[model samples]
Target: MTPPVYTTGQVVVNSGSPISFTATDASGGNRTAVFTGLTLNAGPNTIRVRGSSNSSNTTPFFQNYITVARASSTSVVSGTTTTPPTQTTISSPYTNSAVLAGGFAEGSLSDLLAMAPFVPSTNQFGSWAYGNSAKTVTNDTITIGWHKGLGGSLTILKDGSGPNLINNNASITTTYQGQTRRENGRQSDWAGYGTPFGYNQNGGGDPYTAYSPILNAQQRDSGIGYNWVAGGSISQDTSRILHYETRTINWDGGLRQVTYFKTQPMQWELRGVVDSTYRHVFYWLKGREVKVMFIIQTFRTDGQQKFRGRLQEGPFMYITAPHYRYFVYTGTNPTGETGTTGLTQINLSSPCEGAGTAGCPNQNDTGNWTSTGNWIGALDESNNGVFIVTPYNSNFVGKQFQSRSGDENSNASAYITAGPHLQNIDLPGTNFLASASYYVGSLTSFRTWYNSAGIVKMPFSFSFTPGKTNGWWSENVSGKLNSDNRYEINIGGNGGQGRFYSPEGSWMANTIDTIYVRGRFYGASSMTMNLQWKRPGETEIQIAQFNNKTFTVQGDGVERTYAVRMNGVTNWSGMIAFVKLTNPYPYGSFTGNEKFIPTYIGKTNPN
Candidate 1:
C-alpha cells in the first residue's frame, strides 16, 4: 500500500516478508485501520508497525498504543513486559567519626581539635583551636585567626609564636632571669589595623565598607558588619571537608571555610557586598605560599560604573632576627617596557615613598605603573626572600608597591596595591565580572614550582578575516581567507612573517610546552620555518636563539599538523607577549606568491 501524503506508515511480519501500510488522515478524534488474513508462527510471531513524517517539515505524530489479537480469540496482546530490579543505597566514603569531627555539634569542637594535628609524608598540617574565644587555624608556617574580639578580621602569625605578619602592632613585656624585657607580639585588638578586604563604591570618595563574620561595636560603626546569624554546617569527604556559612548583607553573599588536609592547601571562600556590588575572595594557604584570587561582580547599575577596591591580604612585616632589607623589582615600566637591566634592586633600610631618589624609584615614579613582568621579591641579607607574583591580569590598570625600612622600634613592612585606579569601566546593564590572581611564596621555591608543577592551560583561537587582523599582523606577507575558511598567507618578500601579539598582556611562558599548528605549505619542495617570540618587557621581536626553533616542513600542498616543542627551547623562560612564524629561507627558494595556510594554533601542556 502507498503511504499517505506528508505522513508515513510501515508494517512487517515475522520470518516471512516486510510490507508497507497507508495511514489515512484523521481529524479531531481517534481512528483505526485493520489488516486481516495474516499467517502466524508457533510461539511468538513478531509484528512491527512504524510511523514517520514523509516530508522534510518538522511536524510530529503520535501513537497511543499498538494491539494484536489471535484469529480464534478476541484477547489482545500488547508487546512484552518485564519486572524492574530492586533499588539499593550506596554507602558514603567518609567515616562516621570523620563527619562528627568535621561538624559543629555539641562535642564536635573537641573532636575537630583532636583531628587538627594531621601529619603527612611531606609537611605537617598543624592544628585548629579557639584563641580568645575566636577560631584559629594553624599550620607549621603560619597561624590565621578570626572572629569577634579580633574585630572579625584575619590575624596572621609567623610560625605560631612569631611576630604578626598582617600588622606590626604586637607588643608584650616578659620577665626572664629576673630581667624585665619587653617583646613584640600580636595586638590585643585589630581595630584600625585590620587586614580586611573591602571596596569603595564612589571611586574612593567615601570610606570603604567591609564584611566580616562577627563585627564588634567599633567595627560596626566603622563600616564593618556581619550578615551571618548562625546556621553554618560542615561536611567532609575522603580528601577534604568544607564549612558552609550563609550571609546576607546588601545582597545574599555566602562564606566558606578552608578544607583541612595535609596534601591540599587550606582554602577560604569569602564574600562581601556593598551597595549593588559584590566581591568574592578565595585564599589558598599551604606552607609559605599563599595564593589569592579576587572576583568582582557588580549588579543593578544604570549603564557604566567606576569603583576602587583591594584584596588587602597583607602588610607583611619582616622578622627582626633576619631583617628583610633588600627589595628587588622584577617587572616592566608603566608602558610595558623593560630597561637595559631587567632586575631593579634597592635597599629598604632607607625609607622611600612616592618616587624617592633615582636609584630607589617606586611605582609612583612611573605614574600609575602596571607590571607586565608580574613579580617582586623582598630578601634579607642572606637572600632568604618572599616573592609576590601577579602572573597575568588583563583587567589590572594601575598597580602600586609600598615599603618601609625597619628600625629598632618597628619592623619593616611591604605591601602591594592592585586595582583599576578610577577607570570608567563599561558595566553591561546590571552585570559585570572581573578577576585577578596573586601568588605569594619564597622566591626560590616559587620559581621552581612556577616553572614546572604550576603550569596551567593557555588556549587562544585565530580569525581568518582579510582586514581584521585581530591582534595578528603580517610583515612582508599578505593574507586572505580561502573558501575553506583557512587563513592563507602569501609570502610577498623573502623574510615574510605572521605574528600574533597578545592583546590582554603577556602569557605565562612556562605554562605552554607544545604549540600545535595545523595548516599546509604549498608551491615549493620544502621550506624552512622558524618559531620566534617576544619575552615580557621586550619591545622588539627577535628569532628564538635555539636550535629547536628552526624546523623543515615539506611543501606537499596537503594539510598537515605540526608540534613545536617549546620545552626544548632554552630562551622560553619568562613571560611571552608575542609569537610569530617566519620563512627564514634565502631568496629564490620559491615563488614569492607561495601560499602558507594556517588553520589552527594552540598552546598546551602534553604532560
Candidate 2:
C-alpha cells in the first residue's frame, strides 16, 4: 500500500553545512500535513509525524520554510550559493480544533472573487458580457452590476461612489446553494426563502430578497457564503447588465467545487449529480470553450461501470464527461442493460455546460451511450435536477451587430445574416437582454426529430410584429406567428433575437460538428459575431437535402410531410430554410455521445 509522501524541508545557510533528512510514514498512523521551508536540516534529520484518534498527540508548527543551503553573505554570488546540511528538524502538529484564522490566500482565487461580485441589481438592468472596458475601478468600485436573468436580485456596490453610493447602503445577501443549481422554484433551507426559480413559466424577473429563514443551518451545512450587498446606479454603458457573487450556496453540496464567476461581466454556471461515484468533470480552467448540459433518461437503474471518450491536450485542451439517464415514460420502453426495477416518471436532463464545445464534433446522430441511472430522489424531490433548472440557466439577451473592412455584420459582404436566417449572429445590439432558450421538441412525422445533439439555440428579445417581420419566427416561443407554430430552424432573424434552430433550421448531421455556445452578450457597440458553424463551401448544412441529420421518430409509420433542406454561408452567398410538421414523436431521439454537452439555455421573466 505504498502511498504516503508528505515532505517538507529547508534551513542550510552559511558555508559550513552537512544536513541529511528523511521523514517517512507509510500511513500506519495516517494523518499527514507536512508543510515547511524554514527548519528541516542541520546534521541528521528524520522526523515523521502521524497521529489520529484520542491518542498520542504533538502539534506545533510555525512553518517558516527557510531552505537556503550555504551562504557566506554577499548575496552568495554564483547561483546565490546557500549549500548543504546545516540544520535538520521536523515536528508534527495535530490540534486544529478550530482557530486557523488564516484568510483566503494560498491561491486566493482572486480573493474569493472580491467577495462574489456578479452584481444582479442596481434596481434593475443586470446581465454582463463586455471586453472593451471592465476595469479601471476607482469611482464606485461596484465596477459593474446587473442580472435580471434567471431570478434576479443579487445586486452589489458598496463604493461605486455615485450620488452617495446609492445613498449610503452596504449590500448584504447570503443564501448558499440550492436555489442556484437544479432550482425548481424555491421554498426552504432558511435565509430569506421564497422566490427560487422565478416564473413566467421559467422566464420571469424581480424578487431579489425575501424569504430567508435566518441562514437555516447554512442550508444543511454546505458552507460557502459572503454577502457584502449594496450595489446599484453606476451609470454609463446603456443597459444589458447582470452580475452575481452569491457562492457556497452549498457548492453543489458535499465535497465542494462548483466555483464560477468568470471574471468581470463574464458569466458562470456549473452543476452536479451525475454521480455514480466520481467521473463527472468539466474543466476549461481558462482557455474558454465551455457549453455543457446534464440530465438524460429514457431508461436507467444506477449501477454504472465505465463509459468512454478520446482527445488529448496537456497544458490546454480539455473536454471531459462520464454519464446521462431519463427513464420512465414508457409506451413500451425496453432496450438494453436488462430493464425492470419499477416506478419512474423522471424528467430533467439539460442544465448543460461547456461553452467551447469540448467535443460534440458535429453529431446529428450516431450511437454508443451507456450508463444513465442516477435520478434517485427525496429531500424536496419535486422531480430532481434541482427541481428542473432550465438545464442550468438560459440568459441570452440580444442586440449586437457589426461589420468592418467587410466580412459581414449584415446587409451583405455577399450574404451573412444574423436574423434567425441560420444561427444568430449576436442578434442586433439594442437594450440587449437575451438568454431565451427553447426545448419542446415534437413533430410526429415520417420520423426525423432534431435538436439534441450539439444544439444551436438563439432567442434574444424575440417579438416582432408587422406580419411577423415578413419572415416568421417562434418555434412556439410566441410573438404572433401561427401557421400551426412554424419553426424547423431559424437562428437569428425574423423576430428581434432568435436562433439555435431545433425544429430543424441548421443542417448537416454529417461531418465537422464542434457545437458549444455559452451565453452573455450585452451591446451598444461591441459587435461582429459570425458562426455559420459551417454552411459555406466546406459543405455542411444539409438535412432537407436530407444529409445533416437529427432524429427521434418512434414506432408507427413515423408520420409524413418530411421535406427538409437547410444551408447557410457568409463570405460570399447562400441562404435557405423550411420547416413543417403535422404529427411526430412518441420517443426516439437523444444523441450527443458525451462530454458536458449543451446547446442553449436562457431564463428570466418572473416579472
Candidate 3:
C-alpha cells in the first residue's frame, strides 16, 4: 500500500516508498500501530511523526522509538521515547554579593567596605586580639586603640591622633598652664563609675567609695578628678574584651557594618556588693562625617537583690578636645539656663565654684530630661564638635555635664550620668538592657548625617511576644503575638487595619522598592488585602494603597509569600511616615472569623 501522508498546518507531504502497517491488541482494549520497511541510520537520529483526526484537522505529534537489528538478526526493539530534559536558568535583579554586602555574617566586612561610601585606609576587620597586641580598629573617621599596657581599655582617638580627618579639618593646638595641648587624642578612661552612697562627699557619704567595671589607680589619678575614682576599688577585676567581630546588619534602609565587642561578665565593685553580673556591648559604625558608638548594658542577677542607693553613674565618656571649649545643649532650654529654645551654649573657659574640687562642676544641664529630642554637644570656635545623642528608650531620665577646667589640667572633659537615680527598688532576678549612641563630627553636617544614621540603624522586628507589639499598633482590629512567634490578627469588620506609624519619618521610601510579606490566611470567601502607606508632608489626604491577593485563600489555611512592589506607585516616594494593612470586604460577605497570621515583613530593592 501507499505510505500514509503527513500534514502540518496547511502543508502535506507523501512518503517516498510504500510501507506496510498492522494493528495489534494491547492492554485495556487499546490498539497499537506498527510500520515496517523503514531504513535506519547508524547513530542517533530524530524521527518526527504526526496524527490527524481527518484530512482537514491535524493532531499534535509525539515521539516513538524503534530500533532495528542487523540483517543477520531477527529481532527489533520498540518503545516510546522522550527528549532529554533541558537545563533552566533563573535570573534575578540582585546578585548574591549585593544582597549580602551589609548583612550580618562571617566575611561581611570586605563586602561592606566594597560598597561603602568611605573606606578606612587601615582595615583591621577581624577578630580582636588581647594582651600586648598593637591591633587597632580604624575606620574612615576614628581609631579605637587597644591600650598596650592595660590590654582592656579602648581609647577613642580623633583628628591628629585618629586615622581620618573630621570634615577635612586638621587638629589644633593651644597653651594650657604652659603645657602643650592637642585638639584630639586619648581624652578619658573607657569605664563607668558609680556609688551606692550619695555623690556628695560632704553630705555624710563615703568619699573614696565608688563602683566601676574598669576602675584602676592609674586612671583615677589622671587629674580629671581623684575623688570620682575610688582607690580601694582599683584592685577589682576590670571588664575584659571577651569577643569582637565585624559583622553586617540589615537596618531600616539597607545594610551597614556593625563592629561589635562584648565584655566579660564583671561585678560592679570589688566585693560581691550587688551579687550581679554586668556586661556591655560596644557597637561602632563609621559614617562619612561622624563616628557613631552605641553603648548597650545588660544586667543579670544570680538571685533577688535590692540596689537601694542614691547615685548610680557611668558608661561615662570624657572628651578633652582643647578647642571644644563651648558646651551646647539642643533641647528645651532650662528655665534659668542659657541660649534660645531648643538650643543652649555654655562656656567652659572659666571654672565654676569648686571647679578643681572633686565632682565640683557636675551639674544637671537639663532638668528632668526625658525626650530623645534633646542632645548634649560640645562645639569649638570653628563649629566643629562632638555630641552624645539621648537614648531612644525610657532607661535614662536626665542629662548631667561633669566638666573640669581652670586647674593644672587645662583641658576640659565631661561625663554623662547614664544610669537612673535609684532610691529603693527591687530587681528580682530581672534581666534588662539599655542603649545610647554618640556622634563625633562637625556641627554643619550634623542634621543630615544624624537623620541618615538614625534611619539606617532604626530597629524593626516582627518576632513578637505577648503584650509586645514590636512598634506595631492596631486600629479596629485585635491582634496578639501567638505561641508560634506569628502575629495573629482578627478582623471584625471592613476597613479594620494593623499599622506602624512613625511621625518622625523612620523609613526611607525611596530606597525601598518592594515589601515582602509572609503569612497564612484562613477564610472561605475571596477577599482583597491592601498594603497602604502615607507621606507626612504630602498634600493628599488619602493613603496610598496596593492590592495584595496573596492571603486570599479559600479556607485552606496555607501559608504564602508575596511581594508588594512600590516602584510603580507614584506616591511611594520620599520619607514614609506610616504603613498599614487593611481589607475592604463587607461584613456579611466575609466571615469576621477570617484570621490571618503574619510571620514576617521585610523591605528591599528587588528590582
Candidate 4:
C-alpha cells in the first residue's frame, strides 16, 4: 500500500505551472511525479493521506511535500500569467478529555545553577573497558573504582565509610527481544555499549551533555560504540573542546545517528535516534542537572503475529550504598505537598523489601505501576542524591520503581529500577517519555528547579512547512519525510542550506532566548547545517550550529521578529527541528517534543 502523504503547497503567482516531486520507494529506489497544465486554487489546498501500515515492503517509505512559491523578485509580465495554488494551512485537531496545561521556566545552566560545580564523569562512572568496579559497602554507602591503564585508579568512595570495603560485585544484566545484550552497570550500558565481540569502546570518556570538564582519554573513559568498533572518533578542536562522532551502528547493525555539543557555561546535550526502532535517548544539561530524556513510538505488527516489547527497561540508578532514604509518589498531593511528586518516601520493611509492607521483590513481575504523578528521589542523611521524573501521559503510561539487591531480596548488591515497561499484544507506539537527574548537592537545590516545573509540560501544536533556504535567493528547495518523520532534504542544486521554518505568529520570536536543533547524520559527508534566525529585512544570524548540534542565545532584540531556519549546506537526510525557548538556556534542556510534527503552536516558556 502507498504510504499516506501529508503536504502543504505554497501557491505560486503563475497559474498552469508545473510542479514535480521525487520520492524514494521501500527498495532504495526513487520515483518522480510531475503535474502539468493544471488549474490552480486560490486558498490552502490540503492533501491528507489515509494513514495505514504496511510492514511487508522491504523498501524505504517516504512522504514529500512539494511547495511552489512565487519568487519575491519575479517580474509581473503583461502576458498570460500562471497562478499557482494558494498556500495551505495544515491542521489536525484532537481533544485531551481533560484540561491539560504544561509550562516551564527557560534559562541557561548558569542561569539555573549559577556557580554550582558540574562534572560529567566520576570514578562511579561505570564502564566495562575501564573495568567499572562499583561495589556496595553498606545499605547506605557505596564505593566505585576504575583503571586508567597506567595503574589501578584510586578506590573513589561514595557515601560510604570503613576503608571502602568492597562487597560482592553486583552484576546488572539487560536483555532485548529475550536475548542477553549486556550484564553490567546500568541497562543503558548493556544496551548502548559497543558490541560484545569487540573491546574498543568508541567515544569512551565522551560526555553526553555539553560543557563537561576537559579530561584526557583515561579520566573521561566514555564513548559510543557500534558493530564491534568505535563508530567514529573524538577529537579536541583548537578551542580545547572535544567533539564526538555523529553516527554509529548498534549491535543489531542498525544506524544510530548522534549529535552533541557543550553549550556555554555548564549546559551540554546529545540528541538523535536509531532509525530502525525510532528509540531515542536525548541528553541535556542545565547547570549541574543532567536530564536524560527518553522517547519511543509504538509499532503495529501484521496482526497475525504476536509480539511483546519493553519500551524502557532501566534508567536504574544503582546506589550500592546503605542507609539511603527513598520515596516514590503515591499520587496524592496533600494541601501543601512541597515537591512535584508530593515527596513521599516509600517506608521499607527491610532494605530488600522495597516499600514498607510491600513484600519480596519479584523478578518475574513486570513491575508496572499506575501513577498520575511520576517521580522518585533517594537521598542519604548527607543529602547526596539521585532523582527521576517522568511524564504522566500515554507515552509513559506505566511506572515501575523497584529497589533490589544481588539476588531477589538478598540486599547484597542494591540497585533501583526507575523506568517504564509495557507487556501486551499488538501494542501501540509507546513514547515512554521520562528524565532523570543526579545531584551531589542538597535536595533543596534540586527541589528549586524540580518544583518550579523544571521539566514542565507544554501543549504542542503547529502546522509545519518543510523547505530549505538557498542563500535567501531560491524561492524554495524540495525535500521529503521518511516513514519515521525524518527528512531527506535535497538542497544542493547550487549548494545551499536546508531550512524548516515554523508558522508565522507573534509568539514565533522570543527576546533573550535559546534555540536547539536535534538532528541525525545519514552520511552526507560534505553536508552541514546550523540554526538561523532571519530578521524582517533579510538580515540573518546563526544562533546555533546544527551539525549534530545544539546552542543557546543571549541578549535582547537579537531578532525580535524573525523566521527560524535549520539551514543545511548540501543534500541531507535525517531528523531535525528548530526550537525557541524564552530562557537564555532551555530551562530543563528537554526539547525533543517537536520531531513528529514539524511545528508547534503552544505558549513559550515565558508565555
* Candidate 4 local lDDT, 553-596, one digit each (tens): 22121222223333442211221112222212222322222111
**Cα-based lDDT at residue 527, candidate 4:** 27
Best by TM-score: 3
Q: Predictions ranked by lDDT, top down?
A: 3, 1, 4, 2
Model 2 Cα lDDT, one tens digit per residue, 1-607: 2222222333333343333333333434433343344342333233333333334432221111112344436352232111211112211111111110111011111222222222222321122321211211122122222122212211211223431110111122221111111111111000111111222322443212211121111111121111011111121101112222222233211222221221111000101011111001111111111111111001111212011011100001000011012222111111112222332433222222321255422111111111111111111121211111111111101111111111101110110001121111111110001111111111111011111222222221122211111122222222221232211222222232332332112222232122222222322122222232222123333422332333222222222221122223222122112222211121112121111111121122211
lDDT (CA) per prediction: 0.34, 0.19, 0.36, 0.28
Q: Model 3 TM-score?
A: 0.38
- The predicted structure with the larger TM-score, 1 or 4, is 1
Off by over 4 Å in 3: 1-134, 148-153, 159-237, 248-257, 265-275, 288-315, 321-341, 346-349, 352-372, 391-412, 416-428, 451-607
| Alpha-carbon RMSD, candidate 3 | 31.0
- The regions of model 1 sitting more than 4 angstroms off are 1-135, 145-160, 168-274, 300-374, 394-403, 406-412, 417-425, 428-441, 457-535, 538-575, 578-607
Q: 1-607 in candidate 3: lDDT tens per residue?
A: 1111111111011222222222222122322344444554443222333333346533212212222222222333222321111212312111123221011111123333444333334323232222234345545665554332221333444643533211211133432112332322223222332222322432543332213222222222222111121111222322334344554556324465554443432222322121122232334455532333322222322212212222233233444433334343333212223333444354433335444467565443432222223344555556655555533221122222333322113333433323333211122211122234456666656655554454222332233222222334344444543444344666433334333221122355667777776666677646666666654323323663232222343445676666777776766765454466665433354546766666556673222
Instruction: Give lDDT: candidate 1, residue 485.
Output: 35
lDDT of 1 by residue, 139-207 (tens): 466555442222222334344465544443223333211223222222211011111212232233323
Error of 1 at 411 (Å): 11
Q: What is the lDDT of residue 52 in candidate 1?
A: 34
TM-score of each candidate structure, all chains considered together? 0.34, 0.18, 0.38, 0.30
Cα-lDDT of candidate 4 = 0.28
What's the CA error at residue 407 for candidate 4, in Å?
A: 15
Q: Which prediction has more favorable TM-score, 1 or 3?
A: 3
